[model samples]
Target: MSEPNVLRVEGLRVHYQTPAGPVKAVDGVSFAVRPGERFGLVGESGSGKSTIALSLLRMIKPPGRVEDGSVTLDGVELLELTDEEMRRVRLARISLVAQGAMNSLNPVKRIREQIALGLREHGAAREGRAFDTFLTELLERVGLRRGVGDMFPHELSGGMKQRVCIAMAISLEPQVIVADEPTSALDVVVQWQVIDTLRRVQSELGAAVIQIGHDMGLMAHSVERIGVMYAGKLVESAAVRDLFRAPLHPYTQLLIASLPSLDGKERLQGIAGSPPSLLNPPAGCPFHPRCPFVMDVCRTTMPPPREHRPGHFAACHLYETS
Candidate 1:
């Protein structure tokens, strides 16, 4: 039998109420992340990738609510947990390394103090020398010097600050870590370094990782499986190699084709048109507007997910007839 999934999300729908209408940020999306697995969610900005991350922790703010779906983590239904119960689960079981996390740190607090706060709140460490030693170890695990913890957020480079965030995320040895655009805003060289650090630390702790980002190239290398999201829905999902080798969905194909080749011989192609406005999304398939192979059925009726291969699944009319 297959190992139980560390995290499973089913039919999740997060909508924001506005003067215009309900913005379907995450409309009927579902996927699973196995223990110690690296799952990547890739798409353009406003594709609802980040919204899924926030929903996993039940952190959706006012005007936005999880209208439907179940979020099960380690057999426990996260959507059923109370606010106080979820708070205990946050760092103790699942942690988040948010996008632009470097800037999210308090500028006034020392790095050590910030990290120690979580540990203390969760009762993971005692005060005094025990906490100091634990904090130092956490910093070193993320490839930072132990002494760097004494410095304020402004004192460190962007990359170093990101590392500190990663360290904090792993401090409690959580079963899963949601890293939403952890390497965003950093240079290419620093991006790779941060990715490497994340991979190493996650491996050491045996934690499943959900790496969310717009860069398919980075996701291709960083994750074992990939899920392509378009206009608040998951269009395709498959193993990294399988998805790259034979993408079944038109949107997935376009995304992969848009990436520049290493040899500089193949011309990169860009996807045509912009994503539909979520408030007034296209009637049927959300991607039908920009899809090159869109048919009449696609414009009027939603396509159901079809299994093209053993593990590959795609939601498109083209595969419906297969």
Candidate 2:
């Protein structure tokens, strides 16, 4: 039998209450991450991809709140947990590899201290030498030398700092690891190295990973399933190979087309128009303004999700009639 999902989000709606109006940051988004799955969320900036990640951990700040829906991790309702209960859940069950490694790490603390802080918080540390040995093992698991842990964050390169963050994330052996743009702002070689490290660590730890970023090419190779988000909604979701081979949604097609081809035979195409403002998103279908195949029904009524294949699904008016 197949393993059950480790994380499941249903009809999640996170909105920000601004003075001007309410911004629907994450409107009715739903997806699942199975055990040991590498799930990728891809979209343009401000598409609510990061917001969804924050909501998973109940990390939404004031003015922004998880208005509705359920986030179930290991069959527990995360939204129903109290603040203290959620705190206990954070590093022990789920951890975040935040974007911008330089900012995530403390410039004042050494790498060993930062990683040990997580272990200490979770009460996983043993006395004396045992704790030190465990810490060294964590560093080596992420491709870092044991001595590197003694150096400060400023002493390491961007990629090395990122590795430290990864090391800290898996330090607790959490079941789920959310990596938001873990490879942003790195050179091509460094990007691949970080990706490789992440893959290896996830394999070793057997943790389900949610990798959020805008680069479809990177997601294509790194994840098993891909979900395309647009204007605060999931436009399409499918296995990596199925989505790339036959994208059902126009937005998914546009995003796949935007990726540069290594063979240089295909011209890169840009999606037209800017993404809609969540404060006053378009009615019915939020992507109607930019979708070339939009119909009158698309502007008048929201399209329901349709299963185009065994595991592929999309929310588009064009698929409704198929």
Candidate 3:
């Protein structure tokens, strides 16, 4: 059976106007999310992972327009919607579990009230007992007790806050969930717990999830497909198994090499050079300066995405079938 597309992004380019000039934060990126599938976007800081996530709901702030692209969720184009229309879609259709859950929650509001706010805004019946039952079940599903909902955000621990955030994101049963660094700023155990909750929720709701993180191990463990970004552009994207086995892009190879394994025998070595500044990125391949296998052609021409292997794509000239 053909997989259903839950979200599709095409030629997505987000640029921010700064005093230095226009900074290309997300440059000509394209990817898709299938129903019930987990798609991982892995990259270092300034690689535009968060920017692309924000652009999905048309949340890019002033001077950071989505420039040119189509962000369509289940046939509805988000970029063309008005502010009011977009707001409805933000939580109901596509919700973002922002990077910092501890700070994202309102300190003064009770968890139940905050969750209710999402329910009421999304037109879910607020006066019915069925909704109340569902809310209670949601807290439990996220590993939180019902009584925790009566507590304020500040009263909950970091892990509890993250769980509350997850509950809020899925409370509306959104078709697509953008989890941007959902595990950042937490202890290892908490991170694992949050990831586990997200995994279970995605499976239960049959919703597509776009997990954004810079850590390869976390991304590998949580996602079925991985997209590697460098200097605002997608360098490689493939099935998780295929990517870990044979990464096509040099940048991807470097990222995989840098992952510290649990065996305590593997040494991690990060990529040599730092990512280029977005304000004045390198001329051709943004990763050319850092790529160990840089070719003359890579230094002068931007390589277009090509099918390096069946079902795998990369933007490196060396991997281009053409």
For model 3, residues 192-303, the per-residue Cα lDDT tens digits are 9999999999899998999999999898789999999998999899999999999989888888888777876866697887889999999889999988898899889999
For residue 297, what is the lDDT in candidate 1? 94
| Model 2 misplaced stretches (Cα beyond 4 Å) | 1-3
TM-score of each: 0.97, 0.96, 0.96
lDDT of 2 by residue, 9-60 (tens): 9999999999999899999998999989999999889999999989998999
At residue 240, give the lDDT of candidate 2: 99
Local accuracy of candidate 1 as per-residue lDDT tens digits, 10-119: 99999999999999999999898999999999988889999999999888997999999999999999999989999989988999999999999999999988987878
Candidate 2's displacement at residue 206, Å, is: 1.3
lDDT of each: 0.92, 0.89, 0.89
Error of 3 at 97 (Å): 0.3
TM-score (C-alpha) between model 2 and the true structure: 0.96
In TM-score terms, candidate 1 sits at 0.97
- Least accurate 10 contiguous residues by lDDT in model 3: 123-132
